[model samples]
Target: MTMLNQMKKSLGLLLLCTVLESHADVLIDVTATMVDPACNIRSENSSSPLAIDFNIINSSELNKSAVVKDFSLYISDCNFSKSLAMVLNPKGGSTLSYNGKNILATSIDGLGIDFTEVTGGTIRALEMNKKQRIYPERVNATLYRMDLQAQLVSAVPIKQLELGEFTSTVTLSVTYN
Candidate 1:
């Protein structure tokens, strides 16, 4: 072949190889992190019923009441064999009284019932980051708030002692696209 034709052929082959390399698939990496809150439960008397107080904080950036349904809490101990505990449902009202103190029940009002059953609980995600999911679990008795009123009965003794610094971990599961 002529020198000019041979050079043209080599250039054409190089261009073809470059095009093939450029068509190779591109790769991307995705990652997520989950974190639970540090929770502690203490009982003054084993014989008397203990009332635990659970406070929910909207540390996220969301701002809607319906978001409450997106989260759940799971409570278990070192044994991990016993059935999960149950949390008391907040009375439908503007405020709830515990120990002669009036506390708001809804997040909109200010005070929030952040308490939930350690085994199965739910919290609304207000204006939180859309890519993140947080679930708070309870470590001790579900009845964190106690009403020391005339109707109050002797506190129920907490059994199956899982003593020590109990931590109610709030796991955060994130999904990104």
Candidate 2:
């Protein structure tokens, strides 16, 4: 056979064998309760809004450094004793969209916020940063404390800092499970 015909024949045989191969299908199903969990937070300090303020800094210093602050979440008085953890759902609409790491997304030009999962840590990209699990064993057990730090980062190159307000607001909802 000619080269063209020989190549076509080989291709057809490969396709036919591939189609004749055996195969099986698999399926997965998931279910959950429609009723919400009775894990209503027993504390009330969840009202006060947490704010991170990076007081005015010399543009030169800001361009070369990061400003960090500590913040906390307080929850108390669980109806029952149990171990629970919290997950934060930071509000979207930020131009600094986080790619699932621990970086904070911001809209302010030349600036971004880095969040560290608790105090005494490096600022991280925005992700489902969870607070350390807490067990409420008593009516007033040590309140659920989620200590976190927010750092003001400068994305600008050295000595290219822009002078202006650098701020980001996220309406995060914490779910305990």
lDDT, each prediction: 0.32, 0.55
What tens-digit string does per-residue lDDT give for candidate 2 at 1-177?
699999999999999999899688989898877743444442234554555677776766654565677666555544334456545454664534333344455555656676655423433333444453443323245445545667666565645655676666665444445
| Top TM-score model | 2
| Model 2: lDDT to the true structure | 0.55
Per-residue accuracy of model 1 over 21-129 as CA lDDT, tens digit each: 8856778898888634332323324322343323342333123222232222232222222222222323353343433443324333232333222223233322211
Models 1 onward score TM values of 0.27, 0.53
- Name the best candidate (by lDDT): 2
Residue pairs clashing in model 2 are 43-76, 102-124, 102-125, 102-126, 103-124, 103-125, 103-126
